[model samples]
Target chain A: MKNFSRFTLLSLLFLYLFFGNCIVGNFSSVYAQDDWKQEYSSVCAKTQNAMILTPEELKSYIDRCDKLLALINELEGEQAATEKKVYTKRVKMCRELYQFALEYKEHK
Target chain B: MAPIQKLLSAFIIALTVPVSASAADYSHYLRHIPPAENFGQVVLDNYSHKAGVLPVTFDHWLHRAKFTCRLCHIDIGFAMKAEMTEISAADNMSGYYCGACHDGKRVFDGRNIFGSCAENYTEDEGKRCARCHSSAEAEERKYDYKSFSEKLPKLPGNLIDWEKAESEGKVKLTDFLEGVSYKREPLKAQDDFTIKIRSWDVIFSHRKHTVWNGCELCHPMIFPSTKRGTTKYSMFQIMMKGEYCGVCHTSVAFSVWLCAKCHITLVE
Candidate 1:
């Protein structure tokens, strides 16, 4: 009984330290960082640079890229598809870049 | 009461007290955040923490005197946060970001606005770096917010109106880049629409937003690619925190008390 009481006292003390007034809120908890979105934008910029199309020309090129991406996604889902994971990731990147391009236009 | 029961009650009381005290502490922190030196300074801190340094300061107060917020934030493609959009000095020099307005021949700064970049690089042009990197301590603020904003045509009707002066053409913002944004076709703006709120019935207007932020200010980052609801946010979180709307709402744009701006309905 004495040991049980002692263990209970230790556990209560531990709980007080862990979740009590020890940790104060800092900037990180106050803000949410969107790492996923930042990575997406970076990937998009790299994929589109190879073509080097003018602003007007870039739109049509991006549209075609979007169609190609949808086709690739459809192919990947089929029963006998053999596309590599890298290829699938690249297609996803292209579609995201195309959307970013459209967003650029809307902003303009 | 037995010893065990007495201890249990003490623990429960201890837990409740801290939670209540912590909430009060956060509320106090929100009330005490310092005002920034300038709007650009505030924007830079918010932007840099989120992304990185912008190619330039991109002053709203200076630019809005001649142009409207719609001209650049909408038409020119400047994001609200720096580095979110890939802005290069090369792009600006070619009339992309600051180049559209700073072009030496047509648009000049004060009276001598020049092209985005130099035709030739000068060997000793270190002094000119402060033009965009005005965040350095040496730079002096040209306009005082209180005096400058006092005479603004569109003075804010609410607690703090960050965009009121800029919206009324009291500030001139440049949109065309001498080289990058070569195409200068006039834009016929679409009529303002009421973006339906999902969880609440608050209707956000495109017209009011255009006064402070053009389309590019939000776009795919805050809103997203497809027409989907923005991530859920709470008033308590935004007022005392940072995020999409909180970026401005808590800082310069408006005070936290103006709940009607977003949350239209009040629950009794």
Candidate 2:
């Protein structure tokens, strides 16, 4: 009976360590992916507001986009297809916003 | 078999676990070399390519040859990083940032040079737009770097010896602008100090830097004027974070490959 209790306790401990770590790791990874998407969206919003900015101010915003792009690149293989598409779209929007700011005239 | 042994075994396993496979090799970053013409050139494309306009290729060598680094970076508020400055067409036209000097009226020598990104450009004048907006492949540079630098005395590296050029009175740096700059008495620069590192001592020269970059360039921004040694920095931070000496030394001022320049004092 003592041996049975000892074996059962060991099994429970093993299960806790193995399954708990997997669950925690998976949750963190998902959380990080979501965080990246939110970050990209935030940068996109900033890029949209490029019209009112000076040349130097616009450059800093574009730099933020570049940094996000770098982060997305690091998550290349691990990223979900949907997430990848969203990131790509955000990057494109940022580029377009930057281009628009370049030739943007106040009068015409 | 005991709980202590089991815990010890787990700890050993954790310690033995392999690190990340994608660990970056920092050596490659330290060894990067920029092309001759493209050395200090930064592509400002915050919105150009997106707006169907070509990215503005700003060559530092071209500008630095004529003006001081402090003029644009400090006074004009140009960011050190390329594409980091959000310059728009309207901003330049109002005689701010690039427009401050690039205005056609600003005299360089005796010529009334054409204005930068002129708003009311004629059909014939439209062709001149490509002068600044030239792509990587289609650059139409008026001054050849090699030919221009040839007359100047040679330095150890491929870069033009800017310090020597300044010392010889070849390049006269203008510190103050008429409307833009608030004139004040230049602060008496502190004497050169030596900072000790592992087996080497770095001699920091304030005199050489103050010639082109006034106190405003480094003080209170890159390095605090409050007190010396208060801000803690490391070589890793300088190389990675692009702080301290890494700001200019890595790309424009001089390549970090010239180790002997700073790491002069060697311990036995």
DockQ of predicted candidate 1 = 0.02
Name the docking class for model 2: incorrect
The candidate 2 chain A region of ten consecutive residues with least summed lDDT is A78-87
Model 2, A1-108: lDDT tens digits are 999999999999999999999999999888987777667656554432354567777677667778777777667452244334334443654555554554443222
For model 1 chain B, where is the 10-residue window of minimal lDDT? B179-188
lDDT of 2 by residue, B5-123 (tens): 55654563344222432112222323345655667678888877875667888777778878777667755667677766577665667676677777778877687756776667788
lDDT of 1 by residue, A1-108 (tens): 999999999999998877664453333322212232233233333332422334555576466556554544554232213232223443343555446655545555
DockQ values of all predictions: 0.02, 0.01
lDDT for model 2:
0.63
Candidate 1: segments with Cα more than 4 A from true spot: A1-108, B1-37, B40-60, B64-77, B84-95, B108-110, B114-126, B136-141, B144-147, B153-201, B210-217, B225-231, B236-241, B247-252, B255-260, B264-268
Q: What TM-score, to 2 decimals, does candidate 1 have?
A: 0.46
Query: What's the CA error at residue B247 for candidate 1, in Å?
Result: 4.5
Model 1, B140-235: lDDT tens digits are 334544555566653123222446554555455555443323232223233454435444355666566644443334544455443334344443
